[model samples]
Target chain A: MARRNQHSKEELRAMAIEALADLVEREGVDNFSVRQIAGKLGYTPGMLYHLFVNLDDLILHLNAQTLDALNARIDQAAGHGDPMAVLKAMAFEYLRLAREHTALWQLVFSHRMANQAPVPDWYVDRTRHMFEQVEVQLKDWVPAADQRQRQVMARTLWGSVHGICLLHVENKLNVAGDVAPEAMLESLLDHYLSSCAREGEK
Target chain B: MARRNQHSKEELRAMAIEALADLVEREGVDNFSVRQIAGKLGYTPGMLYHLFVNLDDLILHLNAQTLDALNARIDQAAGHGDPMAVLKAMAFEYLRLAREHTALWQLVFSHRMANQAPVPDWYVDRTRHMFEQVEVQLKDWVPAADQRQRQVMARTLWGSVHGICLLHVENKLNVAGDVAPEAMLESLLDHYLSSCAREGEK
Candidate 1:
């Protein structure tokens, strides 16, 4: 009676998000719009409204998935015996994931919300989870550091690697004869770990 | 007499760039267009085309100016007695500029050109000039390091600081009760300098 093929609201929602992800991967977040997504998914704008409260809500959901994929790759790089080695592997994995999903990974950082819009709790939790991965490995390397000190250390180290990947992904860092991203990550870790060693000795 | 109001092509070009800079500063690059610039400057888009080949060319010019402003800030933070001290000052200045001109600074890295379209030579020169400032200060400190080693070292150091500033600019690095950007930069510098000291000792 319902046109011989009826889909539940949840199924439609999943279909929309999947189609949106494909669109974002190909054209980037900046260029894509809700109207385009609706068109791509063969739904009217009014139908999309029935599915998502707003475009921002849709983007938030999309970003959550990107964070999960990053987290899984991060988990693979974990549990290595050496704390330094674990951190290094995590850095490599993070960069590799960024390269693999250039637009999606960039959306994690580049997408801006409206002014005074509180970042949703789910998004914050996802981000904090990623930071926790770094914090846990750092604890082994700097056992004496207090909680506050370790938090600062985790952000500092991850921020550095994030910067390296950002530059590499944006094609801004290859001016000097195409130095591989792996080399850059290794240089950063070598310098950072050597400093930690020196501190331990002191 | 052709016209009472006669401006040379170069003068009109400069005027368009200035108006564009103001437009980007106020409205952001995403919300601006050549038509808007023509509207602001009392000219037609066709007239504007005589000056800049395309919108991309106009953006490249604007980016060059931003890079110069950044290079000037880097220069001010240079020549300080302590290499570590100078590095810290440069980091602070870099963050300050980004905060002062958030959109403009972001455009420096966020603006992506089409594939197969090479970055203009002038833009490359401006970027290389900024890196060279870091290299000169590093050479005085790491006096015995050769050219290739110093190049890698300069990029590594700059990349770390750049990462901190980028995170701070994007509001992604502040999760734990507002750790100062200054504190993060210092932690990175202190650790990096200590590593260099250990390397020198070896």
Candidate 2:
């Protein structure tokens, strides 16, 4: 019975986490308080404390959950077709995810270890594995003459995607004004594909 | 007399802006409120708002200032240096600034946009100019490559840099872990440089 009660409490805590995320997004994460989070859910601050230790604890969970979701999206994208196809799909899907879940995505990417220490290998492994997978697929796309150039190609292509996404996220681009992100990305794709052929020339 | 007062007000706002930037770096942007900003300097939120409409207005000012600073850095790096070298430096500097001014950097990159309309062309110009500069420099790096191929190479390289920076920002790895960001950046540079050479090989 105690175990059952504890499990139920954990589930409620998860729900609270979602609510907390919504609240944070609605109200800027800055100046957010435990009291406000509890108020939003009609609970007392002490009740909230029973589940998570503090704001940092809540944040850590949110960051970890976002990364897990991102990895899942990449994995799902990877499953659709050939490795090369999957690689392209993963890139698009990751960008889409970031666009759609802007708040959650930003939280994971921005509010991280301000004065904290180094990153762990497990986290490094998950991230590295995804990029390596992309590199592998890219190698298959490249001409047989330059398979050795996979890693950098992977990095460079990914950087362009990110640059565009960063622009979108920050509202830094007047996307509706002249050139749209889609058009920009389309050009990027065309350029990258042609560049692969150039690798064979020299 | 009115003009003199207007100029003094502008000067005070500018000073406050710089102070706010420094404070955001020291304290997570999420940690403070307008009241705190006022408290830091023995002023009032009313005084802060007199120069701007509200907290969000102040944020916009700070973000625009940060972007201008970033452009200067990019311009300096992009000038007279080898294109790839400049591209690499521009990227590293972007990440360096992100680390140094976590709050302001987040404002510039994250979707923290509020009460804001679509992004303007000035932002796009910065990005387009950067990309164009990169393409021009790459022409000298390779033996006459097609524009499309160069674009892809540029995109891929940019992605790699973003991925590394995003990784750092998201704290996907342990902030207290073993991998040094500088060493990781160096690895990325080496890999991309070699990859650019590979692009010419075919």
Residue B68 error, candidate 2, Å: 2.4
Off by over 4 Å in 2: A1-7, A18-42, A80-82, A99-102, A113-164, A175-202, B1-7, B99-104, B116-163, B169-202
- The docking quality of candidate 1, as DockQ, is 0.60
Give a tens-digit lDDT track for model 1, residues A56-96. Answer: 77888888999999899888889677888998999998999
The candidate maximizing DockQ is 1
DockQ of each: 0.60, 0.18
- Scored by lDDT, model 1 comes in at 0.81
Per-model TM-score on C-alpha atoms = 0.91, 0.67
Cα lDDT, model 2, residue B35: 81
Runs off by more than 4 Å, candidate 1: A1-5, A28-31, A114-116, B1-4, B114-116
Worst 10 residues of 2 chain B by lDDT: B171-180
List, residue by residue over B1-202, the lDDT tens digit for candidate 1. Answer: 2333588878888899898889988986466888999888887787777788788888889899999999898898896768878877888888898889988998887787744479988889888876788778778777777877777777777787888888888788656555677777888888876676567656
